[model samples]
Target: MTDEPRRRGAARTDELLRVTLETAAEVGYAGLNVEAVARRAGVGKHTIYRRWPTMAALLLDALSRVWTTDLDYHDTGDIRADLREQFLRSAPALAAPPIGPVYRAVIAEAQADEALRATLHDRFLRTVEESTLARIKRAQEAGELVSGVDLTFPAEVLCGTLYYRHLLSTRAVDETAVDALLDMFMAAYGT
Candidate 1:
Protein backbone atom coordinates (compact mmCIF):
# COMPACT_ATOMS: atom_id res chain seq x y z
CA MET A 1 0.00 0.00 0.00
CA THR A 2 2.77 2.41 0.87
CA ASP A 3 5.47 2.99 -1.73
CA GLU A 4 5.06 0.00 -4.06
CA PRO A 5 8.35 0.81 -5.78
CA ARG A 6 10.29 0.46 -2.55
CA ARG A 7 8.53 -2.79 -1.73
CA ARG A 8 9.29 -4.28 -5.18
CA GLY A 9 12.86 -3.07 -4.88
CA ALA A 10 13.32 -4.99 -1.64
CA ALA A 11 11.78 -8.10 -3.14
CA ARG A 12 14.04 -7.82 -6.17
CA THR A 13 17.10 -7.51 -3.98
CA ASP A 14 16.17 -10.66 -2.10
CA GLU A 15 15.56 -12.54 -5.33
CA LEU A 16 18.88 -11.38 -6.73
CA LEU A 17 20.70 -12.67 -3.67
CA ARG A 18 19.11 -16.10 -3.98
CA VAL A 19 19.90 -16.40 -7.67
CA THR A 20 23.45 -15.15 -7.23
CA LEU A 21 24.23 -17.94 -4.77
CA GLU A 22 22.79 -20.53 -7.13
CA THR A 23 24.85 -19.17 -10.01
CA ALA A 24 28.00 -18.91 -7.95
CA ALA A 25 27.74 -22.56 -6.98
CA GLU A 26 27.02 -23.62 -10.52
CA VAL A 27 29.54 -21.38 -12.24
CA GLY A 28 32.09 -20.52 -9.56
CA TYR A 29 32.73 -17.08 -8.02
CA ALA A 30 34.90 -15.87 -10.87
CA GLY A 31 32.12 -16.65 -13.30
CA LEU A 32 29.35 -14.72 -11.56
CA ASN A 33 27.73 -12.02 -13.72
CA VAL A 34 25.17 -9.37 -12.96
CA GLU A 35 23.24 -10.04 -16.15
CA ALA A 36 23.02 -13.75 -15.43
CA VAL A 37 21.86 -13.14 -11.89
CA ALA A 38 19.30 -10.64 -13.06
CA ARG A 39 17.93 -13.02 -15.67
CA ARG A 40 17.75 -15.90 -13.23
CA ALA A 41 16.19 -13.76 -10.54
CA GLY A 42 13.77 -12.15 -12.98
CA VAL A 43 14.92 -8.77 -11.79
CA GLY A 44 16.32 -5.96 -13.86
CA LYS A 45 20.06 -5.29 -13.95
CA HIS A 46 19.48 -1.83 -12.48
CA THR A 47 17.76 -3.37 -9.51
CA ILE A 48 20.81 -5.48 -8.67
CA TYR A 49 23.26 -2.64 -9.23
CA ARG A 50 21.19 -0.31 -7.11
CA ARG A 51 21.28 -2.82 -4.25
CA TRP A 52 24.91 -3.92 -4.68
CA PRO A 53 27.37 -1.75 -6.54
CA THR A 54 30.00 -4.34 -7.35
CA MET A 55 30.19 -8.02 -8.22
CA ALA A 56 32.17 -8.81 -5.09
CA ALA A 57 29.72 -6.92 -2.95
CA LEU A 58 26.80 -8.78 -4.46
CA LEU A 59 28.55 -12.12 -3.94
CA LEU A 60 29.33 -11.22 -0.35
CA ASP A 61 25.69 -10.41 0.24
CA ALA A 62 24.66 -13.66 -1.43
CA LEU A 63 27.06 -15.71 0.69
CA SER A 64 25.69 -14.05 3.80
CA ARG A 65 22.18 -15.29 3.04
CA VAL A 66 23.24 -18.71 1.72
CA TRP A 67 25.06 -19.80 4.85
CA THR A 68 22.39 -20.81 7.33
CA THR A 69 22.80 -19.39 10.83
CA ASP A 70 19.62 -20.79 12.33
CA LEU A 71 21.56 -23.29 14.40
CA ASP A 72 21.51 -23.09 18.21
CA TYR A 73 23.92 -25.10 20.34
CA HIS A 74 22.76 -27.10 23.36
CA ASP A 75 24.32 -27.49 26.78
CA THR A 76 23.96 -31.02 28.17
CA GLY A 77 26.26 -30.17 31.10
CA ASP A 78 28.86 -32.27 29.24
CA ILE A 79 31.34 -30.54 26.92
CA ARG A 80 32.29 -33.69 25.03
CA ALA A 81 28.69 -34.57 24.23
CA ASP A 82 28.05 -31.00 23.15
CA LEU A 83 31.02 -31.01 20.77
CA ARG A 84 29.81 -34.25 19.23
CA GLU A 85 26.35 -32.77 18.81
CA GLN A 86 27.74 -29.66 17.11
CA PHE A 87 29.88 -31.85 14.89
CA LEU A 88 26.85 -33.84 13.74
CA ARG A 89 24.91 -30.66 13.08
CA SER A 90 27.74 -29.17 11.02
CA ALA A 91 28.53 -32.33 9.07
CA PRO A 92 25.55 -32.07 6.79
CA ALA A 93 26.25 -28.48 5.79
CA LEU A 94 29.95 -29.25 5.43
CA ALA A 95 28.95 -32.06 3.08
CA ALA A 96 26.65 -29.79 1.10
CA PRO A 97 27.87 -29.41 -2.51
CA PRO A 98 27.33 -25.68 -2.69
CA ILE A 99 28.38 -24.87 0.84
CA GLY A 100 31.92 -26.20 0.56
CA PRO A 101 32.74 -24.30 -2.61
CA VAL A 102 31.08 -21.14 -1.45
CA TYR A 103 32.93 -21.25 1.86
CA ARG A 104 36.25 -21.81 0.14
CA ALA A 105 35.68 -18.95 -2.25
CA VAL A 106 34.75 -16.63 0.56
CA ILE A 107 37.83 -17.61 2.57
CA ALA A 108 40.08 -17.03 -0.40
CA GLU A 109 38.43 -13.72 -1.16
CA ALA A 110 38.68 -12.56 2.45
CA GLN A 111 42.46 -12.66 2.20
CA ALA A 112 42.50 -9.88 -0.39
CA ASP A 113 39.40 -7.83 0.37
CA GLU A 114 38.81 -6.06 3.66
CA ALA A 115 35.07 -5.63 3.07
CA LEU A 116 34.71 -9.29 2.19
CA ARG A 117 36.57 -10.17 5.36
CA ALA A 118 34.11 -8.13 7.37
CA THR A 119 31.22 -9.87 5.66
CA LEU A 120 32.64 -13.31 6.48
CA HIS A 121 33.36 -12.25 10.04
CA ASP A 122 29.85 -10.97 10.63
CA ARG A 123 28.04 -13.73 8.76
CA PHE A 124 30.02 -16.91 9.47
CA LEU A 125 32.93 -16.64 11.88
CA ARG A 126 31.17 -14.63 14.55
CA THR A 127 28.21 -16.96 14.59
CA VAL A 128 30.43 -19.98 15.23
CA GLU A 129 32.35 -18.14 17.94
CA GLU A 130 29.17 -16.99 19.65
CA SER A 131 27.72 -20.49 19.73
CA THR A 132 30.97 -21.97 21.03
CA LEU A 133 31.23 -19.27 23.69
CA ALA A 134 27.78 -20.04 24.98
CA ARG A 135 28.49 -23.78 25.13
CA ILE A 136 31.88 -23.34 26.77
CA LYS A 137 30.53 -20.91 29.35
CA ARG A 138 27.90 -23.46 30.25
CA ALA A 139 30.53 -26.19 30.59
CA GLN A 140 32.68 -24.01 32.84
CA GLU A 141 29.79 -23.16 35.15
CA ALA A 142 28.87 -26.85 35.33
CA GLY A 143 32.50 -27.64 36.31
CA GLU A 144 32.78 -30.13 33.45
CA LEU A 145 35.60 -28.09 31.92
CA VAL A 146 39.07 -27.94 33.47
CA SER A 147 40.01 -25.14 35.84
CA GLY A 148 41.80 -22.19 34.22
CA VAL A 149 41.11 -23.56 30.75
CA ASP A 150 40.50 -20.82 28.21
CA LEU A 151 37.10 -21.51 26.72
CA THR A 152 37.62 -19.70 23.40
CA PHE A 153 40.87 -21.54 22.65
CA PRO A 154 39.29 -24.98 22.55
CA ALA A 155 36.48 -23.82 20.32
CA GLU A 156 38.93 -22.17 17.92
CA VAL A 157 41.17 -25.22 17.87
CA LEU A 158 38.38 -27.63 16.99
CA CYS A 159 36.44 -25.45 14.56
CA GLY A 160 39.62 -24.27 12.84
CA THR A 161 40.65 -27.88 12.28
CA LEU A 162 37.31 -28.63 10.68
CA TYR A 163 37.50 -25.56 8.42
CA TYR A 164 41.00 -26.31 7.17
CA ARG A 165 40.19 -29.97 6.64
CA HIS A 166 37.09 -29.09 4.69
CA LEU A 167 38.74 -26.39 2.56
CA LEU A 168 42.07 -28.05 1.81
CA SER A 169 41.39 -31.74 2.00
CA THR A 170 37.90 -31.44 0.52
CA ARG A 171 37.04 -34.35 2.76
CA ALA A 172 33.66 -35.12 4.22
CA VAL A 173 33.62 -34.56 7.97
CA ASP A 174 32.96 -38.00 9.42
CA GLU A 175 31.87 -39.44 12.75
CA THR A 176 35.33 -40.93 13.38
CA ALA A 177 36.94 -37.49 13.29
CA VAL A 178 34.21 -36.19 15.55
CA ASP A 179 34.74 -38.97 18.07
CA ALA A 180 38.51 -38.50 18.06
CA LEU A 181 38.18 -34.76 18.63
CA LEU A 182 35.65 -35.26 21.41
CA ASP A 183 37.96 -37.75 23.04
CA MET A 184 40.73 -35.18 23.22
CA PHE A 185 38.42 -32.45 24.49
CA MET A 186 36.97 -34.83 27.02
CA ALA A 187 40.41 -35.79 28.28
CA ALA A 188 41.30 -32.15 28.73
CA TYR A 189 37.97 -30.80 29.97
CA GLY A 190 36.11 -33.64 31.64
CA THR A 191 35.92 -33.14 35.40
Candidate 2:
Protein backbone atom coordinates (compact mmCIF):
# COMPACT_ATOMS: atom_id res chain seq x y z
CA MET A 1 0.00 0.00 0.00
CA THR A 2 1.13 3.61 -0.59
CA ASP A 3 2.39 5.51 2.41
CA GLU A 4 -0.47 7.32 4.20
CA PRO A 5 1.59 10.38 5.09
CA ARG A 6 2.80 10.86 1.48
CA ARG A 7 -0.72 10.47 0.05
CA ARG A 8 -2.16 12.99 2.52
CA GLY A 9 0.72 15.35 1.82
CA ALA A 10 0.05 15.21 -1.89
CA ALA A 11 -3.65 15.96 -1.40
CA ARG A 12 -2.86 18.85 0.91
CA THR A 13 -0.39 20.24 -1.61
CA ASP A 14 -2.97 20.10 -4.42
CA GLU A 15 -5.54 21.86 -2.29
CA LEU A 16 -3.04 24.56 -1.37
CA LEU A 17 -2.15 25.10 -5.03
CA ARG A 18 -5.83 25.58 -5.92
CA VAL A 19 -6.44 28.00 -3.07
CA THR A 20 -3.21 29.88 -3.67
CA LEU A 21 -3.99 30.51 -7.34
CA GLU A 22 -7.55 31.57 -6.55
CA THR A 23 -6.26 33.98 -3.93
CA ALA A 24 -3.57 35.27 -6.25
CA ALA A 25 -6.23 35.96 -8.88
CA GLU A 26 -8.47 37.79 -6.36
CA VAL A 27 -5.55 39.66 -4.79
CA GLY A 28 -2.34 40.49 -6.62
CA TYR A 29 1.00 39.05 -5.59
CA ALA A 30 1.64 41.90 -3.16
CA GLY A 31 -1.50 40.93 -1.29
CA LEU A 32 -1.05 37.14 -1.49
CA ASN A 33 -0.87 36.26 2.20
CA VAL A 34 0.05 32.79 3.44
CA GLU A 35 -2.56 32.95 6.14
CA ALA A 36 -5.19 33.80 3.54
CA VAL A 37 -4.19 30.87 1.38
CA ALA A 38 -4.32 28.48 4.30
CA ARG A 39 -7.72 29.74 5.36
CA ARG A 40 -9.01 29.48 1.80
CA ALA A 41 -7.63 25.95 1.43
CA GLY A 42 -9.12 25.00 4.79
CA VAL A 43 -5.67 23.83 5.86
CA GLY A 44 -3.70 25.05 8.85
CA LYS A 45 -0.91 27.59 8.36
CA HIS A 46 1.62 25.07 9.65
CA THR A 47 0.50 22.61 7.00
CA ILE A 48 1.27 25.13 4.27
CA TYR A 49 4.64 25.96 5.83
CA ARG A 50 5.37 22.26 6.23
CA ARG A 51 4.84 21.84 2.49
CA TRP A 52 6.10 25.00 0.70
CA PRO A 53 8.08 26.60 3.50
CA THR A 54 7.95 29.97 1.68
CA MET A 55 5.48 32.22 -0.08
CA ALA A 56 7.55 32.25 -3.26
CA ALA A 57 7.36 28.49 -3.48
CA LEU A 58 3.59 28.58 -3.26
CA LEU A 59 3.30 31.50 -5.68
CA LEU A 60 5.38 29.83 -8.36
CA ASP A 61 3.23 26.70 -8.23
CA ALA A 62 0.16 28.90 -8.57
CA LEU A 63 1.61 30.61 -11.61
CA SER A 64 2.36 27.29 -13.24
CA ARG A 65 -1.38 26.63 -13.40
CA VAL A 66 -1.83 29.68 -15.62
CA TRP A 67 -0.43 27.97 -18.68
CA THR A 68 -2.87 25.85 -20.71
CA THR A 69 -0.96 22.79 -21.74
CA ASP A 70 -3.88 21.80 -23.97
CA LEU A 71 -2.87 24.67 -26.22
CA ASP A 72 0.22 23.08 -27.65
CA TYR A 73 1.80 23.71 -31.03
CA HIS A 74 -0.37 23.46 -34.13
CA ASP A 75 1.67 22.60 -37.20
CA THR A 76 -0.36 23.74 -40.16
CA GLY A 77 1.42 23.34 -43.50
CA ASP A 78 1.63 27.13 -43.71
CA ILE A 79 4.14 28.23 -41.10
CA ARG A 80 2.95 31.82 -40.88
CA ALA A 81 -0.63 30.71 -40.41
CA ASP A 82 0.45 28.29 -37.70
CA LEU A 83 2.40 30.95 -35.87
CA ARG A 84 -0.51 33.35 -36.18
CA GLU A 85 -2.82 30.75 -34.73
CA GLN A 86 -0.45 30.17 -31.82
CA PHE A 87 -0.37 33.89 -31.13
CA LEU A 88 -4.14 34.06 -31.26
CA ARG A 89 -4.42 31.22 -28.79
CA SER A 90 -2.04 33.01 -26.44
CA ALA A 91 -3.73 36.38 -26.83
CA PRO A 92 -6.72 35.55 -24.61
CA ALA A 93 -4.47 34.82 -21.66
CA LEU A 94 -2.40 37.88 -22.42
CA ALA A 95 -5.59 39.88 -22.49
CA ALA A 96 -6.59 38.79 -19.01
CA PRO A 97 -5.73 41.30 -16.25
CA PRO A 98 -5.15 38.61 -13.68
CA ILE A 99 -2.81 36.70 -15.98
CA GLY A 100 -0.77 39.78 -16.88
CA PRO A 101 -0.19 40.94 -13.30
CA VAL A 102 0.37 37.43 -11.99
CA TYR A 103 2.90 36.71 -14.71
CA ARG A 104 4.71 40.00 -14.09
CA ALA A 105 4.90 39.30 -10.39
CA VAL A 106 6.15 35.77 -10.92
CA ILE A 107 8.76 36.98 -13.40
CA ALA A 108 9.97 39.55 -10.88
CA GLU A 109 10.11 36.97 -8.11
CA ALA A 110 11.93 34.51 -10.36
CA GLN A 111 14.63 37.11 -11.01
CA ALA A 112 15.58 36.99 -7.34
CA ASP A 113 14.86 33.44 -6.24
CA GLU A 114 17.19 30.88 -7.79
CA ALA A 115 14.91 27.91 -7.16
CA LEU A 116 11.82 29.72 -8.36
CA ARG A 117 13.75 30.95 -11.38
CA ALA A 118 14.66 27.41 -12.31
CA THR A 119 11.10 26.23 -11.88
CA LEU A 120 9.71 29.03 -14.05
CA HIS A 121 12.45 28.56 -16.62
CA ASP A 122 11.95 24.82 -16.84
CA ARG A 123 8.18 24.73 -16.59
CA PHE A 124 6.83 27.81 -18.34
CA LEU A 125 9.47 29.81 -20.24
CA ARG A 126 11.27 26.82 -21.67
CA THR A 127 8.03 25.25 -22.85
CA VAL A 128 7.12 28.43 -24.73
CA GLU A 129 10.59 28.73 -26.27
CA GLU A 130 10.56 25.12 -27.31
CA SER A 131 7.09 25.35 -28.84
CA THR A 132 7.89 28.60 -30.64
CA LEU A 133 11.26 27.32 -31.79
CA ALA A 134 9.68 24.20 -33.18
CA ARG A 135 7.31 26.33 -35.24
CA ILE A 136 10.15 28.61 -36.36
CA LYS A 137 12.30 25.71 -37.39
CA ARG A 138 9.39 24.25 -39.34
CA ALA A 139 8.95 27.58 -41.06
CA GLN A 140 12.61 27.70 -41.95
CA GLU A 141 12.60 24.16 -43.28
CA ALA A 142 9.55 25.01 -45.38
CA GLY A 143 11.56 27.89 -46.87
CA GLU A 144 9.47 30.54 -45.11
CA LEU A 145 12.50 32.07 -43.36
CA VAL A 146 14.75 33.51 -46.06
CA SER A 147 18.00 31.59 -46.51
CA GLY A 148 20.15 34.47 -45.17
CA VAL A 149 17.97 35.30 -42.17
CA ASP A 150 18.84 34.06 -38.67
CA LEU A 151 15.97 31.73 -37.76
CA THR A 152 16.29 32.15 -34.00
CA PHE A 153 16.28 35.92 -34.28
CA PRO A 154 12.92 35.95 -36.06
CA ALA A 155 11.39 33.83 -33.32
CA GLU A 156 12.82 36.17 -30.70
CA VAL A 157 11.54 39.15 -32.63
CA LEU A 158 8.04 37.68 -32.76
CA CYS A 159 7.92 37.13 -29.02
CA GLY A 160 9.74 40.36 -28.19
CA THR A 161 7.41 42.41 -30.37
CA LEU A 162 4.24 41.08 -28.75
CA TYR A 163 5.65 41.29 -25.21
CA TYR A 164 6.81 44.89 -25.63
CA ARG A 165 3.57 45.85 -27.31
CA HIS A 166 1.60 44.58 -24.34
CA LEU A 167 4.01 45.64 -21.58
CA LEU A 168 5.10 49.08 -22.79
CA SER A 169 3.08 50.47 -25.68
CA THR A 170 -0.04 52.46 -24.95
CA ARG A 171 -1.75 50.75 -27.88
CA ALA A 172 -3.72 47.64 -27.14
CA VAL A 173 -2.46 44.39 -28.68
CA ASP A 174 -5.54 43.76 -30.72
CA GLU A 175 -5.89 41.70 -33.89
CA THR A 176 -4.39 44.58 -35.88
CA ALA A 177 -1.08 44.38 -34.00
CA VAL A 178 -1.06 40.62 -34.24
CA ASP A 179 -1.70 40.61 -37.98
CA ALA A 180 0.81 43.42 -38.55
CA LEU A 181 3.52 41.66 -36.58
CA LEU A 182 2.91 38.41 -38.44
CA ASP A 183 2.99 40.19 -41.78
CA MET A 184 6.27 41.87 -40.89
CA PHE A 185 7.89 38.65 -39.76
CA MET A 186 6.72 36.67 -42.75
CA ALA A 187 7.57 39.31 -45.33
CA ALA A 188 11.03 40.10 -44.00
CA TYR A 189 11.97 36.58 -43.05
CA GLY A 190 9.92 34.43 -45.42
CA THR A 191 11.75 33.07 -48.39
In terms of TM-score, the best-performing candidate is: 1
lDDT of 2 by residue, 12-129 (tens): 6776787787788788777888999978876679888887778887777766665653546787778878887888778767557556767766666667779877887787666676
Q: Residues 60-160, candidate 1, lDDT per residue (tens digit)?
A: 77766666735577776667777788878877775575576776776776789898788778867777877877787788887877767777888887787
Report the lDDT of model 1 for residue 135: 83
lDDT of 1: 0.76
CA-lDDT, candidates in order: 0.76, 0.74
In order of appearance, the predictions have TM-scores of: 0.84, 0.79
Error at 130, model 2, angstroms: 2.0
